[model samples]
Target: MREEIIVSGRNNPLIDPLLHVWHWEIPVYLFLGGLAAGLMFFAALYTIRNRENNYKVAVQIAPMFASIALILGLGALFLDLHHKLYFWRLYTTIRLASPMSWGAWILMIVTPISFIWSALHIKSIFPNWDWKFEVIEELLEFFTKYKKVLAWIMLISSAILGIYTGILLSAFNARPLWNTSIMGPLFLASGLSAGTAMVIWISKNHDERKRFAQLDLMIIGIELFLIIHMFMGFLASTQVQIDAANLFLGGEYTASFWIFVVILGMIVPAILEGLELKGYKIPIVIPAILVLFGSVMLRIIISYAGQASRWLY
Candidate 1:
């Protein structure tokens, strides 16, 4: 006979086997944040590379979606906050060491810039778009004049935002499932892949769509590589990380993560896109939807699984 007692935090849900404090809000926010980051990253990348004319949807149309996604993500994040009103205090000072602080500042800058970039292209989306105020008109000109600078800012911030989504979890060292640094790059690659799939689904130009599909394929490859690398690293590391890895390898999350995220979300999309590139008539929307679906599932699974994992166990 053996008896053991463990004492962690006073009243932490992560310490409790049956309770989850994060709920759906954190996962939703993570998905949306990653999606917004990926969308804006591509938008800024093409704009900087002078491919705006070539990739109209990536540069002009996607930023609007990114802005909307960011706002919705922020709303989800706010809803998940334990103390919502004190959220404003996060902006009172800059904390370089905290991923949450970095995320807050990045969102503050990237969110408005996404909206501004989208607004600058309002004429393209709505030919008769009107400026309701003189100040809005003036602001548009200033943004247009310094659009290159804005793109640079977006590129940097969006990358940070993408990585921050994963870093946020990795920072919680108690959760072995997310305690690895590889989590950041893996999330970024997944987000970028999702973003590219979105542009492929929305673009009207066949050439543009085809080009982005190729790019998406490349990113998907990288994302897959990162996923495998993450598990390999975990298996080779501590017993705790290995336990965490087992949750996806052969445990309860195995089927969902592998089927939804790995097979349907990534491999299926890659095959469809690959066939499309080879002159097949596969509906781009199918692959796009699968990718988006997988992205959402990935975040949700990670959030819940991380909560289930603890050092005390």
Candidate 2:
């Protein structure tokens, strides 16, 4: 009788395995955080540039949504915690080297500023609300008096918040896709794009809507470049990095990445916006909706695909 030999496939011990510890909460938190940051930043800008229109949706309504979005995003982050009760530990210390530490501190500062920004426009949003209450009147007066200063502070803080969303992921070097310096700016652009889309959707001013659409087109263009640059950097890196890049190129996430994020989210919106700019009378809401949806999908795809990347063979 002939001896039979059998071999079984096994994973390489030298390679580090991919981790799926992050889930839907992470992406949702990131998306909402970025969206809030963008909205607050633009609200501040609009307040400073066009104070005459204090009652406009861009100034009053957007800031209100910004505050709400930040609160909801924080709720998601809280839920994502394993020791939800110990969430206060993040605030107990400020580690200069820790991205999470930076994020905690940033969120702490940004949330109040956002609310203050919205509060400054309370009279415009709720004209019928009674200001007869002494404390309520005093609080509103204080915020209104220092509105300019608050706007400047909100702009800076919101920009940091948007950038921090990307930095949070980029700090995780174990994921090759997230380990890039460009991620911060890329995320900022995406957030701004989403923010502009939101403003376009809500603002009643035709000219303001047109301006935001143009701005979004520019942001989307920059994002496209950054994405290509990111992939180029990955391709030029080590084998592990190349493998990580493959996830977007021709691997598991290729179709969704290209279809949803690239084509539908970016290209199509840009085209529609461009046509609207050229007197084509395209429905601004359509492109705005697409951009917003794309922004969420972009965050989801990057969050999942980044986790899928590993150094192991």
Query: Which candidate wins on TM-score?
Result: 1
Model 1, 58-127: lDDT tens digits are: 9999888898898899999899899988999999999999988998998999898988999999899899
Candidate 1 is scored at a TM of 0.95
Q: Best by lDDT, which number?
A: 1
Query: Model 1, stretches more than 4 Å misplaced?
Result: 1-15
- What TM-score does candidate 2 get on C-alpha atoms? 0.91
Q: Ten-residue segment with the worst summed lDDT in candidate 2?
A: 9-18
Candidate 2 at residue 111, lDDT?
Answer: 92
Clash count (model 1, backbone only)? 0
Cα RMSDs, all models: 2.0, 4.4
